[model samples]
Target: MDDRKTLVLTGASRGIGHATVKRFSEAGWRIITCSRHPFSDKCPWPAGEEDHIQLDLADPDGLGTAIADIRARLAANGGRLHALVNNAAISPKGEGGTRLNSIETPMHLWRAVFQVNFFAPIMLGRGLVKELKAARGSVVNVSSIAGGRVHPFAGTAYATSKAALAALTREMAADFGPLGIRVNAIAPGEIDTAILSPGTEALIDDIPLRRLGSPKEVAEAIFFLCSDASSYVNGAEIHVNGGQHV
Candidate 1:
């Protein structure tokens, strides 16, 4: 079995997740990624496709199977899980990249968004608690600035779910602290990801840096929270925005 530290990162096929996979792998850590799509040649991180989990986090009923597979993979690979990055999220849009306000967003859509954005981290953290405790691991949740402040480009469900995720991070830190596990969140603002729409262009002018944030910068923040440099950090939300929160 490979002895490198293992990281289970979700939504690794593109954008922030993709950048995270590269960051961890370059640091000599072994990564196990998952997303809705099947593993392909596109992601070239070390053993990236060899250990990718092709499962949709929105399927709340199917978490048992997903967690079981992940646990098995970790068991096979040195029986340790150093970090789990819950980065997968879905922000559904309507015609013309419209934002679904609180009233217009349907109950089903709300449930789906919460399933991936909030519940998956809970499930993964709970399901993999043993492996995490064994390695004295860390968990970095990928939240968004929408959770803290409303964004014209992001829908209501997405913002609320991310808010809940940040809250959940606090709860998780309290619960997992005794077991030597650290839990934290990174709240990004207007990163150049595929999920962006034309409406995002206007928000850049409001940014203090006068530029959009990069996936690599967010990935570096994630890496810090997971690495020993931030070992004392827990239940904190690191903003990756270009001073947009200011």
Candidate 2:
């Protein structure tokens, strides 16, 4: 029997998602990654092309097709999915990368944000429940510190979508627990990524750590939640912000 674990991760092209792909791949886990862009020839991961899926999670129709395609790919793993990480998200900004407040954010953009950040996770989870159950899988939703409180950089749409994702994580944990599946969330703060705004450096001094968090740090927390170390942990939202929440 092929006992190697498998993970289905979204948004694996960059930042925390990229770090996560490296972490799991190094651990000898088979990784299936989803992204809006096609697999790049320069991708460093092994079997990157074959294991990569081009998916636009915002389109419900496209997502449905992608789900089926993902299931087909999982057949080689005996229809087992050890982990599902809903890490793809979008944070739209105005000109000069300014925050888009509630009043100014367009309705289309707000809905688009929700579609990717909120709806996609649930849709993918529901679509892959069978595979998840087969492997007694863990699901990790990537949220943000902005979900709980206002942040200067994170826009209104992005913040609300993450908050919704956090809520959905708790609800999924309750519903999936009995099936031997775990669901959790990680709320990150001020991570050093391209997603950060131009003025992010100014806020670092206010952070308790007095520095920005690395993508690898967040990936480590995610690895823990998906691994046996967090077997009993469910419906929990772990904070990856270095005491910034305090």
Candidate 3:
């Protein structure tokens, strides 16, 4: 029953996930970050400690093993895991892009999108339920506004998967509430992340704010849900989309 707050962050190598890790670190929470690639040598964050683990969320075969390793780390550090952020996702690539009506949206692409967006988060949440229960922790699934809207830019698979994730958030919140575990989601609008491919200028213009969101802004919302500040907030979907979803 160590009193120190610990957070397990996925996709922490960059983007919103990276920003969240930095914020939590500054707030004095011990971080266990996961990424497919090793952090760059120039990574200024204090992730050099033994808590960082490299894991590929898209690799379904390795998901169980990765979760086990994370659980082991928590056990070794003292049975404490305050939060889990399921933020790892892959935007569709190539000529298909993420356009909803694109003829190029193949079954393989759809599968890939669901694999990382939907399956990974569900698997990670189920695997870490015990640790989350131990700390009465929350699970925050990073989703997109495209899930709720019919956006041509988001494509079919990406939007559909995110929509499913939103539903999953509600279900998890309901199921885990009695155990003192909270589940929530953040549906970001258009974040200025590298996830969006180049030549997508038109897509940026469609945003009502006329600009992309900063990763730190999204991170702040996530931090709120992770902390006691949002203790009463459960099964909630906070939109950080600059009024796009409104």
Candidate 4:
């Protein structure tokens, strides 16, 4: 029997998610990743195909299907789940990667952003509650520095969705604490990833670090929240933005 811990992570194709997978996998955790794309042979991890779940979080029905699939996979461990990282998110941009403000953004896009960023996290937490309780697991929701303030590149819908996710993290912590589950959030700023919009370098001077954060840096914080080191931490949002929030 595989006695190693198990983690379910979303948006594992690249960037922060990819870094997170490497972080936990190095610590000998079994990773079950979810992404819109199918398992790629390019992935360095072993059993990548068998452990990857191809599902679009933006689709409500697909998310339900993914949850069922995950639960079945967890059955091997008597329904124990050590960690769940809600990291999949979509930031819609206008022509030439222009920011889409609240008024100018279409209703469909707003709903789509919310479905992926906000609704998916809560739904996943609710769906996996039993497994989490059995393992006394932790949940880490990926938020954004834009969630708290207006970012020059992050769109309005994306920012609002992350804000809602942050709030949901707090609510989930309160409700899941009694079950021995911890819930928290991480807000990243100006991370050097594909998700960053063009002209982001201009904001680096304003940050105290005078540089963009690495995806590994954010992954480290997520790892801490999921591990025993953060056992007493709950309902908190850690800033991985190199003093950008200040």
Q: Compared with the true structure, what per-residue lDDT tens digits does model 3 show for residues 178-238?
A: 9999999999987887776555466666667777899999999999999999999999999
Residue 131 lDDT, candidate 3, scale 0-100? 90
- The lDDT, on a scale of 0 to 1, for candidate 4 is 0.94
Off by over 4 Å in 2: none
Over 1-246, each residue of candidate 4 has an lDDT whose tens digit, in order, gives 567899999999999999999899989999999999998887777677999999999999999999999999999978999999999999999999899998899999999999999999999999999999999999999999999999888899999999999999999999999999999999998899876677889999989999999999999999999999999999999999989889
Candidate 1 stretches with Cα past 4 Å from truth are: none
User: How much does candidate 4 score in TM-score?
Assistant: 0.98
Worst 10 residues of 3 by lDDT: 93-102
RMSD of each: 1.0, 0.9, 2.1, 0.7
For residues 17-81, write the lDDT of model 2, one tens digit per residue. Answer: 99999999889998999999999876777888999999988899999999999999888889999
Q: Write the per-residue lDDT of candidate 1 for residues 211-242, one digit (tens) a residue.
A: 99999999999999999999899999999999
Q: Residue 154 in model 1: shift from native, Å?
A: 0.6
Q: Rate the local accuracy (lDDT) of all candidates.
A: 0.91, 0.94, 0.85, 0.94
Model 3 gets an lDDT of 0.85
As for lDDT, the candidate ahead, 1 or 4, is 4
